[model samples]
Target: MRKNTFNIFSFDTTIRNPQRNIDFLQIIDKIDGKVLNEKSLLIYWYEAIGKGIYRPQNINAEIRNKLLKGESLSESEIKRIMQDNPQKVQNGFEGRAITHFKALHSQLLLIYDSQSKVVRISKLGRELLNHPYDVQNIYTKILLGIHFGSPIRKENNRARVFLNTIFVIDLLKREWGKLEKESKGILRHECVFVLGIKDCDYTKCVSEILTYREMYGLKENREYIENYCVSNDLKHLKYDTIKTYVDEVFRKFAMSGLIIARHNYYDFSSFESKKIEAILQHYKDYTFMEFSDIYEYIDFAYNITLPWIENNEVRKQIATQKAKELHISLQDLDFNDLTLLENKLNQTFYQQALKSKIEVSQIDTLLNELRILASGAQEKSSLDNIPEPLRLEYLLALILGKKYGSKNLESNLIYNENGEPLSYAPAGKADLLYENFSFEATMIKNRNQQLNSETTSVARHFYESKKQNTLEQRAMLIAPYIHWDVALFFKFCAKEFDSKLAPISISSFITLIEKSATFSEFSTNFDRLFVDKLLRDKTDAYVDSVNFVR
Candidate 1:
């Protein structure tokens, strides 16, 4: 028994390491006794041997003694025994050091190519040792197989990378699911309903791999064999055919993840997450060949297919409604129209404040000035621009200035080819900056609401030529919004230009409203009285505005 243990350990170690050592069939023959008889003992014995060989040789004397006594080893015992002498044997056993490197090499080849490895042994390999087969425990091993043994990439060959059979199987087992419990699984049905086979099979395979099952035996019927064949929907496929499908599925999944050939392990994991995200970001990323059938399957699994599938009556109704909205035939109303409608809707909301009697001419002027102020304020508010987070403060200043009036506020409007002020790249160019920014629009508005002429307007609008480079960087945009120390403010600019621009006091706001009879009346005067007043200050306050041109 001791000699047999040594031989089994030595043989398996050799077989596992090299590509051409142990004939896998021979190993199977040795272990395949009556399922419940000494063969079972043979299985356990081989298990012990396999465990002993790969395990670190650092066995503690106590645990070693315990294991030698034929006591069933606990996980801790196994671990301790392995750790004490943490090395695997290259050859010798019982002082007979075998130099049969070829035997080891052959064994590894069998392990790699054998059907048993794909079927029974791959599943049972974990049991051959005392190690627990959890996802994390085998993740490194699986990753190793993907990097070293996969057909995708050779050691350093620059070819299209292929995933190993194990990765292929895991991906399918985890990701694919049946369309419905009642719906039979068949290959032809997928090919038929899903539109094509190439991309669909891969998508289905991924879905299968990600799915969980309660019974291990389920693989025999649903996974390993196409036993769900009924009628002409699916004919039972040969092993090679199934293997081909599995291979294609894996290749497609890897391709979708951008796992080209010759990628290193670091490259594989480093970019895998982002690649997966890109694939999942849009439904369109999935190919019609791949997702068409799986779509039904997912719907069925979720119990949403009956209402959606068959003739897709619900879809038709949706299509009809969409067609009505576009005033076109159902066939003419494609997906792009929905996107166009969305853009139009957003634009409507943006124009909500524009629906005033404040003349179309005034609308353009107000919007241009607002854009200038808002853009500048946004740029200055960014931390990158001002070294702090004060976006709200800058925005508040712009908003209040526009609503009340500011003398310290200023702008250089950019005009387009048609001589219209452009919202984006203004026509020519203008660079304007406030020398003094001591304007409080809200305070001025409050004062002006009392209809007091005594409230001196100190608010000014300064203008200059547009800078060679606009504020494009996020840092530049984010800085001005942040809070800065008084010292930092002085360093950025002088204090002489920082005098208070008397914005409309709160009292003045009241007087302006009192002068208006309705919301419409208020809106009419708003652009001229408040917004225009603030905008005109751009010329009034800017000493540079008079001389600067595009």
Candidate 2:
């Protein structure tokens, strides 16, 4: 029987750029074992090809029978049969047979002539036929060639860079796993749909490839395929046909386990979670450390693990059960206490032994070194300079101190017996401290420098002083000009400080001090008055009235 041939020119327009054709093969390779059994197709084609050169009239019948019988024909027997049946050769074309032949031919499994006279299996087809079960490595090589190989030409002198197939596959698998279910469905459907119709015509092939390319964020490849179609004058494929093809491919992939398909959705399920997590780790901004720095350790222990835990009733309950473990009171557990705990946990035995041996003989030298360190260290309050709008804080502090017989305060750096500096301890409560009243000063100048020294000083004092034995009776923020934005910021900080720090304008503070007869009365009505003033129509106008530069 004469081999059937279609007009190669009709489909030449479909794959105008050879690169797009290669890209299609790569898509196939990605789904080889999972979506389609390339080996089954290879075996069927191999046996059919060995049974003599097939024409459209005899190709399908010959292959179907052999497949059903589970039979294989040797090369010599096929040649002998062909020689005996010379009269059976007839010239004609069959559409279904031609479609099947063209599909395999496009994939480079077979070669055919336009005259419908000759059809032969390719070398790759023969290799796949012979080693069908163990052809993964060979299949991978073929796929990589399709993905990276370019036709050689004299005019093109540019270099071509190719990503490693294994690397590309690994990256794609991980990225595929990360995609949401809907995205995975879209990608799977589009890829399969395009490849199914790729051999139909040049325009249909380009449309499918372009559709899939757009979905994958491959703009450069999409543009190349689109330009190729336009330059080649290929007729566009109908939208309905493309949609039908996509649905069909989606169904096939669903059955193959490349993706988990539901009623209307799909998700990638082929990758290992451990491998995917490993890949994801490379993209994270922070890493988990087993032994953190001293500051971070303190933050984790205090803020994260045991915040508000010190000097609490909970310690008494702990003392009843595990009193031996409770070496010190919770109130006395400062940085030095925590450092010693960490050292006991993390320091190796040899390191502790060496340290002890050196410390016994060099105690005086250590004391002198610590004294030098303490003399070199000095703690500066954030409110020291008092920048513009913040300079208003100094005025507020001065006014409060003068009117209430309070004092302007600073933080004092505490030192150990050896004279090494410990934590910075505040000298008194906030910027101004009266008998039981604490007043903080804040100034807002620029948006970036919203919270200056005075603001932080007040916040710190309010947080710490409220925890004292006498307990702070009241705390207030004194700002000359509080922009609406700055006020909102204070509102946020208020939550962090347990709402102890009431932000009030300097003008409001002065008015309250002048009107209230006693400190108790001032504290009782301060919040209500501050809220009334903050919410008044004149608040924005008040911000505008202030001489910010001065």
Candidate 3:
């Protein structure tokens, strides 16, 4: 019998900041075989965070004495801690279940050998580590793929609940059997107070949400939800925690372009709705796997169910949903073939690629998104309350990938479960690497900060990228507003080193649409004119590096 009988949905509260999760993954990935016990992980994590960074006077007497007396304290170690200034609060993090186990809760890492209690990063976790500059696609997939009983959650073994939650949300809002859903979308309040927490069955959850909708109406705020949470005492999460669950965990979930969370109501983005559609056939494959041993649990929970990992129950739901949509009998389609569902998804995505629009409207959308970020507006078409720096980094990756097909470039941003970019990179890598060229982007709008922080960082990235591939090497920096002096500083660096290190402003990036008829056309033209030209003449690389976009 499952200890956690009721399906209580939870995205780890600690995963609120995805960059922190990425940092945790990196520390672990560096370990031998990327494996370790939770106890060892805590000590390693504590040291890596430099948790005792406070000066000897500022530190508590006992802890400081223990360290100073037994260990030879070096001035360099203290200086390093002060210089790093780890700002993430570590109040009781040391004892909080390897609190950063947010990575495991997120499915980024997994308990590879459950018997030995060996924790290791997952395949997806390694991908995230490999690509720390951008994660929109990967993270978004993870968010949508998360289920009520996903083994990826904080407590996988004890829980026995089942639901393809994203599928459920889509079903609740999307038209079905030619009939509109009661709410037409999941309310923010519904997400916080109900959904996976109240019930594992999507149908039952829908009824529950509909009941709430009738009482609270279409628009309900956090206070209203908090009130209901206090009254019900469902699963006993604090009222404050309810707010964090909505604002942080769920906000990250919606950052995926697939989910439009504007107006405080979550629905499928009309354009990206096909993403849900593509996966619709696998909804029933989401189920809780019952395992007797470590190997069995890993095998079944991770693969056997995916009928999609341990992948079989969600396909049943998708088949039913498909039947309703087609207005056909359930007997009409072959729901039993798991391969059919996977193929259906693959077909939808292949169609998605062929459906790419080069129309002016495509650029119009990208440009508009950029403007919203630069103005620092709270309101937008879809994403909100997400970190602006991560958003900027994501947007730049998208823009560059658009200009030069993804096959040509790789980004270095890390993602959360929602597949949204959260951090730029680890210590020494550039934000983007494309055909021997490096591109770095920052959200720092202040000119002074750029001069202090970015000048040396940008130079370092350029040199690192160059060392990897010496051919036709160059680097580009992007920001909302590039300082003239900073641009000139790069120009001086260009003369001293490689001359192609340059910066471009967001304002200039906005004009990208006007300059190019289409993304492919822009890629072709740039490749032929600019990128190809440098290869012909070594002296051409000696030109000034400053783009002067202030």
Q: Cα RMSD to native, each candidate?
A: 27.9, 33.8, 11.5
| C-alpha RMSD in Å of predicted model 2 compared with the true structure | 33.8
Q: Pick the candidate with the highest TM-score.
A: 3
Instruction: Report the lDDT tens digits of candidate 2 across residue range 1-550.
Output: 1122111011222222222222223222322333113343333334333322231222345643442222455555444443443432242112322344444444444344435424455455454444442232233233322211122111111111111212222344444445531232233333322333212132344344445554655333444444443444333344444344444433322221123343343343222122223323432232222322322322221232121135334333323222223233445433434435422322222122222233333323333332222221123322222222222333343333334333222212221111111122233435445556676654332333345544566666666776773653556666544455555555555556545445655455555666666555666667566533444435454344321222
C-alpha lDDT of all candidate models, in order: 0.28, 0.36, 0.51
Candidate 1's residue-wise lDDT over 1-550, tens digit each?
2221110001222322211111233344344322323334334334443322222345566654443322345655544443444334542231111222223222221122222222123322322222321211122223222221113111221111122222332243233333333211223212121211222234443344233233331233344234322222333455455544433333222322223222111113222333222222322222221123322322222231222124344434434553453345555544555445433332232122122211222323433433333233222211222111121223333333344343433333221111121111121221222322222221111112212321121111211111222421100011111111211222222223331122232223334445556534644554455434433444233212211211
Q: Candidates' TM-scores? A: 0.17, 0.23, 0.51
TM-score of predicted model 2? Answer: 0.23
Where's the lowest-lDDT run of ten residues in candidate 1?
473-482
Number of colliding residue pairs in model 1? 111
lDDT of 3 by residue, 454-476 (tens): 78888987776666665756666
Runs in model 1 lying further than 4 Å from the true structure = 1-200, 206-210, 213-318, 321-529, 532-538, 542-550
Order of all candidates by TM-score, from best down to worst?
3, 2, 1
